[model samples]
Structure formats: structure tokens, C-alpha cells
Target: MTVIDSATENVAHTESEGGIISWVRPKRVDVDLVIPVYNEEEELDDSVRLLASYLLGRTNEFGAPVADGTRAAFTWNIVIADNASTDFTWAIAAKLCEDFPGFIRAIHLDEKGRGRALKTAWGQSQARVVAYMDVDLSTSLANLDDLILPLLGNQADLAIGSRLLPQSRIRRSIKREFISRSYNLLLRTYCQARFHDAQCGFKALRLETARKLLPLIQDDAWFFDTELLLLAQYQGLRLREIPVRWVEDAGSTVDIFDTAVKDLQGMARTRRTLNSLSSEGTGEKENARAKTGANATAKAGAGASANPAPALLPDFRGALIPRKLSYTV
Candidate 1:
């Protein structure tokens, strides 16, 4: 459980000679687009380029034009969360950052896994709105406006692109489709989760809401989304699900059997954790015990004082702060 502080100051230093600008202090933005990658070198470049081009032509929902474009006004930053790729993914990402200036930036991590990468990137970024999508772009960049619109309008705390809803169009093998349907059915029945899709990788969240819930997620793999959704529901957050067009990429890395088993196990884990917490008053006693353990550990460190204050964990069960845990799984 590593705690990261993201509220650093933003300072900009300019070099007059070459029109170069460097961020001397941490820079915050309106939106942070987090793309967690494993071995997505094949389609990474095209996906990023497309997103950059689209972002450059949009508006910020204030009905004002952005960058002289005919579209609505919007400002965003794309953060590529590199998950220890073994190919040229990092190099290509670096090149894109170099070529695009402030529109794109790449953060590299030696650890590999979707959840690990996303957690690291989200913790590091300083955006009001934080989002992540699949590297394959299966959800299509065209629907990005729909996902962000709810957040912009304050109608939703989190918005997810759903592929199993009435308005969604999915092109895939019948077997794969059946597996998806079956998984969703199981999730609803066992987990009591209300969302149509709990596994779709295209999702956006307000940074405040995300900060409240992301730390509660325990799974660091494909089941990360499920844990997030379940925790959000437990906390009574407002999550909006919107249908979107999605296609199965030819070289997708999804393994039906393995992923299904893992997802089920994760679901059971979630059920158990929630049940335990509910039974013991949202596990407050357990949390206190954990804090005491942490304090003891901290005291054992070299040159450490015996009476250190217990670090405060973010409370996800608060009232006024709606924990919008919405997503298209």
C-alpha cells in the first residue's frame, strides 16, 4: 500500500531561443488520459496519433470553440502508462512524446500488468478528470465525446462506454460474444452489480472520485475493473453506463478460459471482502488493526521514532462525496 501525493505545484520555464518550454514544477491539467499498455506496440502509434488529432479539434463543453476548431471546447492530456513492454512500445511512445510536445507524455514502469500500470499513472498525474482506454482502440475514438460529456455536464461522476447495451454494436465471434454475455450475467447475479458491462476498458472518472476508490481495488490484473465497480457500488457512487460501438481486434490478447476463471475468482474475493466489511461495520476495526500494524512497522525502521502518527487512509465511505465508480466492463 504505497501512498502517493499528487497535489504538487505546476511551474513552467521557457527557453526563448528555441521555443522550448519545460515544466520546472509539476503541471496539472483539466483531464488526464491514461493508456495502460503491456505489449501493444503494434497499434500504439496509430491510436495515440488519432486521439491527439481528435483532442486538438474539440471544445471544452462551454460552447466555445477550441484552437479555432469548429467543434466544442475541451482541453486534455494523454498519459501513456507503459507496463514493462518487451518490444518497441516504450521507444515508440517516447518518440510520440518528443513529436507532440505537451499533448502527449509517456511514463515508463518496469512492472507489468494492467492494474499496476494504471494505479501508478493515476497516482502520478494531476488532472481533474482521469481516464483510461484499451490500447487497441476497440471502443473507437469517435465515442470519446459521449464518455466525457456526462462528466462535463455534472450528470455523472464516472462514465463508461458499454458494448452490451441496447445501443451498442459489437462485431465478434459468436463464441466470444456468448462468453461476454455469460460473464455479465454472472456478474449481475452474483455480485449484484448494476452496470451492463463491467469489463470494458474504455472508462473515465473524475480525479476526486477515482482517488477515493482506486486504492480499495485489490486485484492487479484483468479483475481490476470488477473490483473497482463493486467497491463503487458498495460506497453508493453514481456510475453512468453508455452504449458504444466496439469491434474485436484481430490480434487481441484476451484468453477466454483463463480470463473467465480469474474474473470469477475475483468476483468471489470481492463478495467475501464486502461481506466481511458489512458484517464488521465496513471493517473499521480491521482498518484500525492494520493501521496499528503499519505504525509498528514504521517504528522498526532505522533511526525511526517510537511514537509516529498513524497515517490516515482515504475514507471511501463518506456521504457528500459521491464515489462515482461507473464503468463499461
Candidate 2:
């Protein structure tokens, strides 16, 4: 969690009239889209340039009524989180930061763990909406609107890309497809989980929701996503699942068998924890269940642009950089 590069300036906190302190976050961006990499030197450069260009509006050919049809211009930046890549991934990320400056920032961690990288980056981010996608860009970039707009509009606390949905258009091998379905099925049968496709690698959350949920996560790897989703449900956070167009690239470096074993172990641990929580209930207010994938006819033209404005909550705030963490794995 070392501050490799402070791409943002820490703004001063301003107070309101009734003495309710407002923590105007250090880097007040609309969204912080984080891409965490372990050893992805080969794919890093092209992916960054591609995604950066889209963010800069260079390749945004599709602004037509996607994701609730709320077309509002908001600020966003990308964070290249390198989690101790043994290859040249770190060097490439640093160079990209130099190339893009404020829009593209890079951070380095001494250890390797996807969850650790995401937690470090998301914890530091005070962006109105914090999001992440895999570097491979397996999911459609157009779906970003679906994943992010709800959080911006306060429609849901968390949103995830789901390849398992019937509306999803995915090109994947039989083995991977089987593995994913089986894994999620196990969660549903054994853990009574409702949300689907926890391993889709595309998700977003409001900064306030992330702030309250992050500290409860323990896994430092792939299981982080599932663990976070489970805890979010336990806390009664509204979760939305959006169907996505995904193409599974064969060049993925993930070790499926090894990851599966580890994931099973993580599931066991998580289930035990959930059981304990069930036995000891809390007296917190229940969260409202969100209706996902609703079809509403958004105003066709410019009228729809101003429909749901991006509203940044008043209390969400954090430091300029994530604090250093202590891990033993």
C-alpha cells in the first residue's frame, strides 16, 4: 500500500453551516477505474492505451442510450495497480503514467495478490464511484455504463457484470464455462447465495459502500470478489447484476485448477464465517432489494442526457493515498 505516485492532490476539508463536517475527498473524481495486474507485461501497454483512449472520448462511438440511458459528463481516471509483477509490468505501468499524467496513474506493491492490489487502490480512492475490470478487456467496454451508472445515480450500492445471465453474450470454452457455472452453483446450493457470477472480473461500487465493506474482506486473491459480495449481502447492501458481452481470451494467465482449489478453501472459510454471523445476528436496519436489469424507455435524445444527474454524496472522503498494509501471506 505504499504511495508509489501521488497523482492527486489532497484537498482541504470544508465544513457546512450546521457543523456537519464534509470531507471533500482528496481526489474528487467521478470514477476511479482500477486495473490490477500481477505479471501482465505483454498486455499492459495496448490495454492501457485502448482504455485510456476510450476514456478520452477518442473511441466512444457508442453513446446511444446504454445503461439507463443517463448520459451525463463526469470526471474519471484510471489507476494501473501493479501488485509486485516479476516481469516488466511495473516499468510499463510507470511509463504509461508518465505518458497520460493525471488520467493514468500507477502504483506499486511489494507483494502479489489481486485482492490486495484492488483493496489498496480502492481504499485510497474517494471517487464517487470506484470500479475495476480485468486488463484483458474480456467484458464489453460499452457495459461500463451499465456497471457504473447505477452507483452514480444511487440506484444500487454495488453492481457486477454477469456472464451467466441469459442475456449475456459470451464466447468461452466448455471447460471454463463448466467451471464457472459449477462454482456459482456450489455457492447457491451450499451458501444460499443469490447474486450470480462473482468471478466475472467487472464490478463497481459507491465509495461509501466500499468504505464500509472493504475492512471486512480477508482473502488476498481471487476469492476477494466472492467474499466481498457475500459480506455485502449480509450487510443488506443492494446488489445489481448486469448481463455483459464477454470473450474469454486464451492467453489468460490464470491457473484454473489451482485457483479452483484455493477458491474452494476460501468458500469453506467464508461459509464458516457466515454461519457464525447467522448465529450472532445484528440489529441493523435492513437494506432494500434492488430491481436489476429493469427496462424503462429513456428519453431518446438530449433530453435523456440530463435525466439522472451524477450525484456525489457529501460524506464520502478518504486520504490522498492508501495507508501501508501489514500482510503475512
Candidate 3:
């Protein structure tokens, strides 16, 4: 064991199937970002490298957020969740764990479902917050700070990226665009959901909240994101939607129409499930929140510049003092 003078500075390592594991061996992290994949060999390496390096650039060698922890916000790592990829995705992910050591890890599942992969990743994670995004990195990374800061400041219980928002910038084929808008429209129309977009892969939530909700989630596929968010809304939890800059992946493998049909079925099932929960009084849902997408934007943390949010970054791996956060609501 590699030992340090104190527990706060201590670190450990163990050789495992995935590689030298260390980060969580001591305790939990501030945030965990999982990239769930299925047969993504071609995009696996580059995407992981880009994402991990981008994350690393935010922190210094002392495991503290850069420049007095303002920009760093949280100590974080990435997990590559492989959903029975029939290719070299797992192998590549394992190598990344080795390359990044404590900052990146991998998990393999025999089943193939984005929801299953996420449920497993988020369920097992010890981070204060757990989040996921597509391997393609469809959403711009700038929006990530906006996504995470709110959850940390208690400004939101969950945060999601939305391409349908008026402020969003997007580029894609007409068919995909139409399908995307139509799906969210149904979510607003029939489901009575207030959030603008439901299916964006980029999402984050406090692990505390995730623990309560993951077990209740039923769908284990593409519809999982939508279902999970709907349940959060049913519980009347705070949700933040950030307008994102997204560019379509031309060689995407998803079968849009087939997924859409399945999603319609899932939506129907979810509508029923939500109604049941509300009737049973299990959700504590707000009539205003469920009926319309008009939840007020949370106020920003007072007396601080907006750039480094909340004014104070918490002590690393230590206690976090909650503060009310304000930003684009």
C-alpha cells in the first residue's frame, strides 16, 4: 500500500482485472461521469482520451480543484460502462483505466441496455453525484460546468442537457430533428412533464437522489433516460435544463425509427406508472410542476462572480457545505 502522512492525503492501489485501481479504494469521489457504450470500438479511444484529459486539465497534481478549487468544483473520474460490446470496446476501456489510473475506470455487463449500464454504473458509484453522456460527445463541454454546478449548490436535484430549448444550437438532419422535437412534445403534451427535453444523454444527479430513484426505474434501454427523469419530476424534485450546443454524429449507429417506436410504448407505460404513483401519493408531485414546464429558475449564489460558481469550492474528499446557487434558471 502506498501510504501518506494522513488519511486526507492518503492513496492506495490494487492490481485488478481492469488494472491498477485506487480512487474509490479509499472512499468516494465528488462526481462520477459514466460513458455507456455498445460496440463503440472506433470511437472509444479518442472519446475517452479527450474527455479524461479535459477533466484532468481542470485539476492540479494535489488532487485539488485548479486555482483555489473555484474552477475544479469537484474531484471527479470517468467510468466506461460496456454493455456487452461485441468488439474491442472493453479492451480499450481497460487500457484507459491503466492509462489514467485513479481518474478512469471500466465495467463490463453481459446485457445490452443503456439504462442497465447506467443503473449499474450509478448504483455502484460512491461519488456525491453521478452523471452520464454519449460517447460521441454530442453536447459541447462548456455546458458541463452549468450542468454540474447546480447539483452541487443544491440549486437543482438533477440537471440535463436540452437541444430543444430556444437558446440551444444544433445541427442535424431533418428527420432526426423532427423525431426529437416530436418525442419531447409528446412528453410535454401527454405526460404533463415540465422539463423541456427528456432524452438528452448528458445528465447528472446527486448520488443521494439517484439511490432513491434508480431502484424505482423500470426501463433498461433507451427509454431509461426519459423514464428516470419523469420519475424525478413525479417526486417533485428540482431539475435544471441547460441549452446545449450539439452537432449530429453522421455515422451514428442508433436505429432512430425503431427506437422511436419503442419509446412510444415506453412513454405510454411511463404515463401510467406516473399516474399510479401520483394517485398513491408516493411522489409528492406538485400540480404546477407536473402540469406545466414553468418551474422558476433557481437564484444564483449571492455575492460571488458567476464565473467560479457558488463562490466557494468544497474541501476535497471532505465535508461539503451546502449553499444556495443562482444562475441561468
Candidate 4:
């Protein structure tokens, strides 16, 4: 991972006297919100202002709460991941950083791509909880409460907003809906991932877990989310999919056909990795001579002769599936 010393890394880590490491340490203040931007001049300013205002309200403008039993106020840093935008996006982002001081910051990357920008910004952040949402705010800032709730409640290591769940209300075209379903189905069949919606752009991860898994992911585009989730699953990290209300924004950069093909390719790669791991485990057992040759041969024969039926994949059973949201051109 490329480590750049940006304003976000100014937050220092604290150590305890007894030497018990605290993984929930907030580097700058509290939460680090990373938004990767690529030619989002139309929506960038509004989204950042909205997020800043909401965060300020939540922490009482970084002041002590006036009421009894209220939690202490904390800081939130907004990291704008500039993916080499050929627009006024970076200028506006820089202005926000200057205006907000320690509260907002911008990191400019000449390399273009959503995944590349996100990975750069995430690595530079020091918050206990690191999060990224789409530039258009299609998922809305209101749903952020649901995404962070699991992390705050200590029930999950990662949380993602799902537009396919029962409580979710997605607004999109039928063609997009059909393509999304087909992509997810292929992912489950080939990669054995339990996540129902792998393409959702709004996702949060515990800082420690993200630090460990982000490097394992190589994709720097739409496939980035899927690769991260797959690596997280392999490492046994807990994940929660919260229902969300997603409005399809016009002028989206997603090319449905191209993205679908890329997603399928990612799933195939994940499947190969899993198969390799399984084979390695079997090889290790064989080298140990844990069983007699005849027994091993018999077991191998049985495994080979056993039905080659594919493993049962997880069902999208936790919640009721919602209808696709219709969009007007």
C-alpha cells in the first residue's frame, strides 16, 4: 500500500500503561469519512456540505453536551479522494479543507479511478471507523446511522448498505435491476460469498480489519468492493448488510455491460483463490501422513466418486427482497 502523509494522519495513536492495545483508537477524532470523487463537480459540494452539517449536529459542533448522560462530542474528518478529475472538483475540495481546517481535508491523486482513489484515502485516514460513500450520495447520508450502528454496538466488523433488502427502496431502471441480479447471482455461484449486495458503494469497516485486508485487494474500480468483501469473508470477519433507500441519480458513470463483465471476472478470480487455498490445506494434511496410504486412497476415491454437486450457496433469506425503483429519463 502507498502510504502518503496527508492531513488525516496528523492524529496520533495512544498507548495504555498496561500494554493492552486498543484497536478502536480514533486517530484524528472519531470517524473518518472518505468520499472518492471523479468529475463529480455537480454533486460534490452539496454532498460534502450535507455530510459536514450532519456530523456537526451529531457531535454538537465539537462541544460538550449540555444534557445529562449525553455522550462526549467527537471530531469527524472528511477526506476527499480526488481521482485526477479534470474539473473544478479539486479546487472546491481544497477550499472546503481550508475552510473547515481540521474537520475536512483533500488528497489529490493523479492516477484516475474510483478504487484507486478510495484505497489512497483510506490508507491515509486514522479514524477508528473508516467509511466511503458514492460521490452522488445515492444512498443518502440518513442511512449512515444504520451503517455505523453495528460497529458502535460491537455486533459486526464491517457494515454495508444494501439496496436489495426488504427495507431498502431502490430507484432504477429494469435493465439495471436485471443486470444487478444476474451479477450477484454469478458472484454467489462462483465465489461462495454470502453477501446479497456486493456492488453497493457505501461501506464501512473497522480500522484494524480494513488495514489488514485492503492490501490483499488488487482491483481499483467497481470490483474493489467485491474483492474486499471476499477477502474479509476468507479472514472470517463479521459483516452486516443494512437496508437502504437508494435513488438512482442521472449522469451516473456506470456502464452496465462493462461493469457486469468485470464483476464476473472478479468472481472467477476469487473462486480460483479459494480453490487454491483448499488444495494447499489438503496437501499439508497429506504431507503430515495423518492417515495410512490405503485409508487416504480410499478417502480420496470416496471424495472423487462423491457427487460433484456444487456447494449450497447462502440464500438471500435474512430479509424480504424489494422491487427495483423506477427512474424517469
Q: What is the C-alpha lDDT of each candidate?
A: 0.71, 0.74, 0.75, 0.69
The residue ranges of model 2 lying beyond 4 angstroms of the native Cα positions read 1-26, 60-72, 282-329
Better-scoring candidate (TM-score), 1 or 3 = 3
Residue-wise C-alpha lDDT for candidate 1, range 1-329, written one tens digit per residue: 11112232222223342221122113577778888887888989978876676677643322234576543245778888888889998788877766666667766776777888888777766787788998877886667878887776677788888889988988888988898889988877676667888889898878878899888989888998888877877776778888888988878887879989999999888877866556455356456556666556643553234433222222323211122233432
lDDT of 2: 0.74
Candidate 4 structure lDDT: 0.69
Weakest lDDT window of 10 consecutive positions for candidate 3: 318-327
> Per-residue alpha-carbon lDDT of model 2 for 1-329, expressed as tens digits?
22223433422223343211111223578999999998999999988887777666666423222333333266888888888889998878767866665677666777789999899889878799999999999988878878888889988889999999899999999999999999999876665567778899999989999999899999999999998987876666778899999999899989999999999999878877865555343212111111212453454334445542222111122111111111110
The C-alpha stretches of model 1 lying farther than 4 A from their native spots are 1-26, 58-72, 282-329
Candidate 3, residue 86: CA error in Å?
0.9
Per residue, candidate 3 scores C-alpha lDDT tens digits across 36-55 of 99999999998887776666
lDDT of 4 by residue, 101-198 (tens): 56676767777778887787777667778889887778866678778766656677889888877778999888878887877776665665567788
